[model samples]
Target: MNRKEANQPSPISRRLFFSYAGTSALTATLVLSGCKDDESGMPVDMGVDLGSGDIGVLNYAYALEQLEAAFYTQVIQTKYSGITAEEEQILTDLRDHEVAHRDFFKAALGSAAIANLEVDFSKVDFTNRTSVLSTAKTFEDLGVSAYNGAGQLLTDPNLLLIAGKIVSVEARHAAAIRSLINPKSADFSGDDVVDTNGLDGQMLPDKVLMLASPFVKTKINASNLPTP
Candidate 1:
């Protein structure tokens, strides 16, 4: 789809989108079907379902990794003017990691994987070091939290193992971004993100989607994902 067409706002919020869809008495079969919101609701352009069960969770991770990959790809494409050599190298590594993670999910899901998601980076100024690092920090932190929160929803032991490995990598990325922003700061395990018990922050799928909505061009219905 064209940029304008892809970027248009969806009529329904992610929270209500799949929740209502599930209750519609429609066929339980999951597929990449699109539908519009009812006339009474906000005119959200409906996107495909993330599907149900473990595959849905994989799609969710894939979607977020896609965003991270896209963001880092953009950052490297147009390096910020004052970016240090260390910053460039680390950002390049981050880009590579995100791309690998994205591809890994795609490979694992095969036919079940979601389509390439459109990402909107209009709010970011790629040429500005501060802006880029700040945004990177935000994404890395969000990614770690997303995986932590979704861990309980994964039924497959293998999937949980894979997720654990990926979350550690994302945590390292977050620390690196934090260090870039503040050279004197502790890189990993930030006080803001970790509690007195030293546990990292966590966020539910709905909350993650809400925070992630702006960057994604394609609407996602994640009501089918497992919750606590």
Candidate 2:
């Protein structure tokens, strides 16, 4: 190979990305399996109960990841009108990240994972860049807040560490979408999402699910999730 070719970084395939992304959480799953609470008794009359304790939190994160992955997949498949090549690449990367995250949680949760969520994106106009990007911002912001809010509820150190890592990625996604919406502006880390304390906003499980209801067809019962 030429010197330039030898210096190039290896391209990462989706399969390899999934394996890398899921390895830590998958290992945590094995460690947690022996000590996690039994979920069979969780109430499901209202809908799918996220379960309880750390499992519930994992399910919650998994559900949101599923929604994001589905949205980005659609965005890439349809490609909003006037989408630049750079925008296409960014959106494609976001789609892959979200899918990897979804698969990671699913693999981590194993039999404890929630069912695949059915999302309704009828409100999103794929032909319109404004509509597509605005919707992406909403989902991305919500995901960041969801992770932040749920972080305190995690009891296991390993799970909490994993959640922290995922939330940071979610924050990056949120910032990227915000920048796309308002380039050269401070909207990416605007005061609306970042408070006076310089910390990102957070929303509890119930509140997060309520805000996410419109996009999700499947009913989620976060009633069983742990509180403060």
Candidate 3:
């Protein structure tokens, strides 16, 4: 759906669009369908040299999706109070999209994809509405910056296009959630999401995770992520 008519899901629900006809979900399922792998054995190598090409870019996307998926999954498992049905559905959709993103990269990358990241959400008060959304806002914004920053690093045109589509959707999500924070904040393109002079902001994976580390109790080593 277009942004104007985009249906807003409640804080508890997910507000995202998914097409079953698309193969991203299929690819994701295929990627995670095999035997379980250990995080220790696989290691959290954000800079695993994804192969010095598009493979690296795909792997990068996969890593971020893993984090996003983990966070949303936790949110749903321990839902907060004062959550509306609409919000619940939105969060669910958000969770599904993150899952699809995680799976999409996993399937697309095949063996190149990293292992599931164990997130630590000990700092987030799932019972508190503000804490949850604030962290959610950070994630959404980081995802947007990440795609924007990393998109240039992608060697393949098709992969770049795919990342564009996904980041656009993420920007929409960032906008919607900001509205809930404060109506005036809904224009995500404003200083909140964007930077001075209306330029898009950038955040390295390390910095992004450091911001996220507060809520996540899991120890992540993004030191290996490829850099420009």
lDDT for every model? 0.79, 0.80, 0.65
Query: How does each model score on TM-score?
Result: 0.83, 0.82, 0.71
Top-scoring candidate (TM-score):
1
Best by lDDT: 2
Candidate 1: which pairs clash? 10-44, 10-45, 11-43, 11-44, 11-45, 12-44
The lDDT, on a scale of 0 to 1, for candidate 2 is 0.80
Q: Residue 118 error for model 3, in Å?
A: 0.9
lDDT (Cα, tens digit) per residue for candidate 1, span 10-82: 2332233333223222233457645667778765655767787777887899899999989998998899998
lDDT of 2 at 186: 89
Which wins on lDDT, candidate 1 or candidate 3?
A: 1
Worst 10 residues of 3 by lDDT: 4-13
Residue-level lDDT of model 2, residues 1-228, one tens digit each, is 111121122233224434444444333321211222348865434666677777788889989999998998899889988999889878888887887788777766777777878899999999999999999999999999999999999877767877888899999999999999999998999998999999999999889999999999987877777899
Q: Write down the RMSD of all candidates, one decimal each.
A: 9.7, 7.3, 8.0
lDDT of 1: 0.79
